[model samples]
Target: MAKTTPATRSLAHAGIAFDVHVYVYDPGAERIGMQAAEALGEDPKRVLKTLMARVDGKPVCVILPSDREIAMKKLAAAFGGKSAEMMASADAERLTGYHVGGISPFGQRRPVPAAIEVMALGEPYVFINGGQRGLQIRLDPRAAAQLLGAVSAPLVA
Candidate 1:
């Protein structure tokens, strides 16, 4: 796998410190994040999953623990909307310019409102997708949120 990706480049450009970790990606895994966490031998809470969603029809990005599910109502409220839903996979792929399993909040083709789970921010470090399957970027969750201008909230169910 290539060591450099748009996600890594974005972090480098922003001067954020991070480490890249590569793992065996399971295409058939029902839960990508959980698979990633297991592959990395990290706690599920430390592996963040990037999700593309729509809040009142507007695109948004959400980051939360791999083991949790998003509360749609809370997600909508987080963005000051009344309703929210997961974006269509095709739309998400198009908007982020990445495949479903490889999508990363960083270096998205189109930037949008983003949120990070409040609980995740407490971790010393978290692993997020590195713009490709089988790849993750480890860094301080606080730094990731700050860099993405993501609002911190209780986003999980």
Candidate 2:
């Protein structure tokens, strides 16, 4: 077993079961999840990505497939907000207590409202950042929304 990340610890405490995956992390990889999909030899759709954003100026977490783009208006609407925008990388890091490429929806420094793109729900399991680069945690997608208090919505553009 590998050393537990904040993400892993959080999940364990929450009583969620998961499998950890590791791969060589290339420094300066622009799209970490896509790089993870390639390195793990998995479909890009199974690798989820976490994005931190502001819906009505309140920080929120958005989970979507690696290959998709977030639809800000739809995201805001799901949250009953007037607008939504991506948080700056620095803000994301500060709020999530992890680097931009490794921000997990679990174990955030502050618990914020979250949304999971509806498509991820159909996946039997999904890989999400495991609190650091080069690592991911595969788990049932519904756990993200059910246990993490995230609403599932059509949040991808």
Candidate 3:
């Protein structure tokens, strides 16, 4: 597709197939995850959104379903950290090279610790941002970890 980013390109090279979907973005909207789910005509619980947080002062990315909220205590416990808080949007953009609403586990500016709820990977289907708002990449859950270097764990409450 669009000469994919380094992360996506690497995925392709590794034989990880993916489908790209793009939609109209509503910049004024606050619920981008819901927007994407609506545009894609998929159940919100089956789709996921990426969140950037600082775990013990280091950037980390956590992927969870749009219908759920991150359990900070669970996250902190899993990582052996005392605290985890959402990072500022500016810091998120600066570190990930993607807007807060459009952050993907792939192609981040740096290799941040990534965690995906174990439930999200129960099935083969998963969708994530394609490095831009209104754009998404659909692929197998296994491919996500292989491509994004993510750790699939139990962090969703």
Candidate 4:
């Protein structure tokens, strides 16, 4: 078995079922999302990435398809904020303790609100990073919503 992260350990303790996938990571690449999808042989749409953003001076997590960008205006509206801006990569790394390509919402310096777009609809499963590069965790979205205190919204445009 792969070593469990604090985040994944907590998740497992909560009885959340997940699958771990590992791959060879290319540290020099820019688009880690696409790389994750390619490595796992999963469709980009089914593989989501977590992004950190500042909304009204507070940090929020946006989970969306690996292939698309978050719609700032819609995000702001959904969260009842005036505006939203992408946080600096360095800030994200510091807050999440993971590199830009491996920002998993499950483990963070703190539990920030996770806002997902409606486009990410599916049954009970979705793919998210497993707190490291070239690693991913597949679990139920409902479990994610409950564990991470995430709110689902139609934030995708």
**Most accurate candidate by lDDT:** 1
Which candidate, 1 or 3, would have the higher TM-score against the true structure? Answer: 1
Q: Which stretches of candidate 1 lie over 4 Å from their true place?
A: none
Off by over 4 Å in 3: 1-3
Going through the candidates in the order shown, the clash numbers are: 0, 0, 0, 0
Give the TM-score (vs. native) of candidate 4: 0.91
Clash list (residue pairs), candidate 1:
none
Query: Per-residue lDDT for 6-38 in model 1, tens only?
Result: 999999999999999999999999999999999
Cα TM-score of candidate 3:
0.90
| Candidate 1 accuracy as TM-score | 0.99
Tell me, what's the RMSD of every candidate?
Answer: 0.5, 1.3, 1.9, 1.8
TM-score of each: 0.99, 0.96, 0.90, 0.91
The sequence of per-residue lDDT tens digits that candidate 2 reaches over residues 58-129 is 999999999888999999998999999999999899888998877899988998998999999999999999
The whole-model C-alpha lDDT of candidate 4 against the native structure comes to: 0.80
**Candidate number with greatest TM-score:** 1
* TM-score pick, better of 2 and 4: 2
Clash pairs, candidate 4, are: none
lDDT of 1 at 129: 99
Instruction: Give the per-residue lDDT of model 3 (tens digit) for 1-157.
Output: 3536654664567788888788876788778888888889987766788999888888898988877888987787667899989899999999988777677778788868888888888766878887777877788887787666777778877
